[model samples]
Target: MFSSGDLEQAKTNFPEASSRDLKGKLLLPGFIDPHSHFGMMISAIGQANVAPPPAGTVTNFSDIIVALENYRDAFGIKLSEWIFAWGYDETQLAEGKHITKIELDKAFPNNPVYLQHVSGHMGVANSVALAQGGIDENTRDPIGGRIICFDDGKTPTGLVQEISMYYFAGKAIEEFQGKKAELFPKAQEHYLSFGVTRAQDGMTDLLSMAFFRSLAAEEKLDFDLVTLHGYASLKNDDLEFKTYKNGLKVQGIKLIGDGSRQGKTAYFTQPYLTSVFGCEKDCVGFPHGPQDELNRLIGLAYEKGIQIFVHGNGDAAIDMVIRAHEEESKRLGQPLDADRRPVVVHSQFVREDQLNKYRDYGMLPSFFTNHAFFWGDVHRENLEDERAFFLEPHS
Candidate 1:
């Protein structure tokens, strides 16, 4: 973590990349980010970055609008063209609140604008954008998603969560099919610049897999990438787990147990002290889907001989995953101590009991330590100080 040329060891070890744009940036050795989803970056290619500090320069709500406006003008986007942007974090804003559609409408009166939340679990859409997404006052919340509303409950507040967010993000990506066929060179170079050679995509949909395969055929994939296909989105169980091809591999099946904690959609045992955009009194967050569905999906993967990697950000969600594993083991009539190692990704708010259960079943745990550093302050405001302080406990 020193200045330019101060990392003499790195220069000497990888002399071949000495000329690949490592300037004044601090590069940590052996600091690999496992969840750098390359497919997401390709989908967001040529879009404005509105994330804070390290990712982008947007500090507040005002910066988001300005950045999008500039991007639209620079790209010569017509009023009829949809505006897409990513990396807007309400927690990092100076206002300490989520941006509203009112502000976006004022900025772009005719264009349909959508800003993706930093967590990738929620999004804010302008009124025009909402209409185009077929969301309206009469639109009901889907089984696994919610269309956050204003006080009236019927009218949307422009913010969509979970499954709802997926729809908007998917629609936006559909327009990027032209960009997906050709791998973006900078996408790989960006990670290389950070000295990260291997990364994993926790959730990969069918379309992304196709894009990955296309890039692999052309030898465009320049580094190792492991992707876990989304279980709910899987059309078949044909993926050969842990098999690599052209620097890319389909590692396993990913199941999302719940949403992000920072987004206040993480299922928890205790309720939040404050209210989220859609949740109020006694809000302990929610699961991404029903328990039976999760169990069925787990059983299906097990039958197909595919590995499972689930995302559980809260204690309740972790409980659900542990239960599913236990049930699956019982169904197979085999000892739980077998060599099978089901992964529990983002076991963020796991309790002591949950840890014991994980050990009892030999489930592998993947923690997000960055949560304590990046979102600790926000957690404190939303959760008990002790709970916030103990996030991603190393032990």
Candidate 2:
């Protein structure tokens, strides 16, 4: 579309410019996923698919049980071997209920079965799996987690929520040692196909970081990987940030302030319209810790010069993060560095006031807008029209 004189002038002005002729073609920029769990997604690919439509298409409770049993039988799994499955949702099932420990026990009496909730904040374990984890009725709940018990309040229903799933699911993952070398490359290829040149492993522990470092040493990766080291993994004083080979960098630290809203575990200022599975009315959910504890963690990360990404899906949780940032800024006698860009990940239920606070604190919100499409109807059911429509509001 340029005239001959204009083209000559452009070439004279920039001799280094190289031109590509494309009469008819489509061109776009590469996608950058700011917040995602690349390692976890790779692991899930190797596990059985039991999620509902689009992800797995397992529609009902019966379908889930059949899928797990089939996977176990096809793999010739021994009775002593553990069976782990992900992508199970109670709301999506035909029965409109969660699979209980009793049902899993009946299906796999010998094997220790662990079925993770689609929300990634909870999971269900059979009796054998519960026993293996030493999680009996007598065991107290962890700081930010809940062991959903039966009506008796003494008998665990095999459902674990929030931080409780971390321990049980973590032990299961330990069994799959050295899998990163095999799975990560495949995940990278899949990302490339989608035009994503840069990816983020939103949460990483020491073990995973060491594996990534080893991969870097071997020069196995082709794309860039940025990891946010989990707070739990940084408890040791010796561990510090370092850039490894193959463009892998430890960028910052991550903290989970609350759980998933779909799973009804995210802390909120008000209760849900309907009670959560295995929970009573007026259940406003819970936070991972008190304000003081959150303040301490944020302060520590700030002192270390690490950017913090706090996961706060509900308004109450976001409030905690805002308060912590404010306290830390005041304590340090300075405002947050805008260039560092502390983020509130998966901020699904933020209110109008919170947006102003975020601007005042120089904080960024990275919303999981996909929830608006995949789980919007379910959210409406739980929150009612008045509150649900306001979820992830852009204004």
Candidate 3:
């Protein structure tokens, strides 16, 4: 605390400024989280109440099944509903492959299961869970994602990628019957305690937006919330996006370009470091924005004044995103507005050239630098030495 004389002298020097005699620590302002998936946070935090795994390497799908059963036993997972879990890494499994539907069925035949990949981009669901959600062999993949079907068979393999995961998983959330009104306030309280004044919620749609608005209306929302409404694809025929777009405090749409390094699905310029073959150039991850679709979506987004928030974890995908943006900008032949900072979210492997391209197009980026801390070793082992140097934070 300052003395009265000191206070007087300070005030005299800055007469127009106000002073705080407050006791608690005060924080400064920033962009806040300009986006996020609060739902994922809630789910992740909520899972702490669940079971624990066995004390060894998860050797295979069988081990995962046993571990989940053990975890469920410890956590009292009710058989009346589904068994939902996250933070499972496939690379560590015995074959370094994901758990299949058959393995899950054998263990928890009576219960439905939904295990999300650590990346939050893909998930494996048991047959019971798929049947509960009405995702079947005949169910075609949505515009943005592919439902991985076992080759030469009509049976669904239970691996749902990109958009399809959201589509069916959302329906599953509905089945849980948890209301947003009851959840958002709890989530907001958690955010405020952490000094978060703003956040950008990924995959936030109009329904979730209404929930946020309701919280604000009721004085429950403590932080300023913004979101990138993630879409399956921006095809003109999709009415859901248009409707949801009109209804939210959304900044734009998100397209997940490929899977994360943890999933070994990220597109790379070279082969995996662990792969026996020092071969397979252009080893890009599965392309979510194939060919002209990305271009078309950018044009549509620009025309509608909605920003594009693409999820590009691989350098190849980043380059594609930059190329698409550059093409769109050249075609428009004008500079974009400062606020309309079309962003590349998760620029985990952006090269210097790509960064230049981003600057050239007046684009903004949101890097998930956290990945470096989380999966740096795997990235180093799998990607070429030159490209691995450029991932995360994009510095």
Q: Best candidate per TM-score, number?
A: 2
Which regions of candidate 1 fall more than 4 Å away from where they truly are? 1-33, 181-183, 232-237
Candidate 1 C-alpha lDDT tens digits along 6-96: 5677777667764546687854664455565677877666677888988799998889988998999998999878888988888899988
Q: What is the lDDT of candidate 1?
A: 0.81
Q: Give the lowest summed-lDDT range of ten residues in model 3.
A: 239-248
Q: Write the per-residue lDDT of candidate 2 for residues 101-199, one digit (tens) a residue.
A: 999999889999898888889999999999998899898788999998889888989999988888777875685556766777788889889888778
Q: Per-residue lDDT for 298 in model 2? A: 87
Candidate 1 vs candidate 2: which has greater lDDT? 2
What are the root-mean-square deviations of the candidates from the true structure over C-alphas? 5.4, 3.2, 5.7
lDDT of 3 by residue, 1-395 (tens): 33345766888877888777667876465446645677665555443222223424455666677767876787697885667776666665656666778888888887888887777777888899888767897998666566777764567888887766875567545543364555556776777776777766787654665565565566655566666665543443332332222223545687666666766666655556664211245444566758577777776777666778887767777777777776776677646433467888777777777777677767877856666765677677777667676676454
TM-score of each: 0.89, 0.92, 0.77
Q: Residue 79 of candidate 2: its Cα lDDT? A: 86
Q: Which segments of model 3 are wrong by more than 4 Å?
A: 1-31, 46-80, 92-96, 132-157, 231-248, 275-283, 336-339, 393-395
Pairs that collide, model 2? none
> In candidate 1, what residue range of length 10 has the lowest lDDT sum?
27-36
- Model 1: lDDT of residue 97: 82
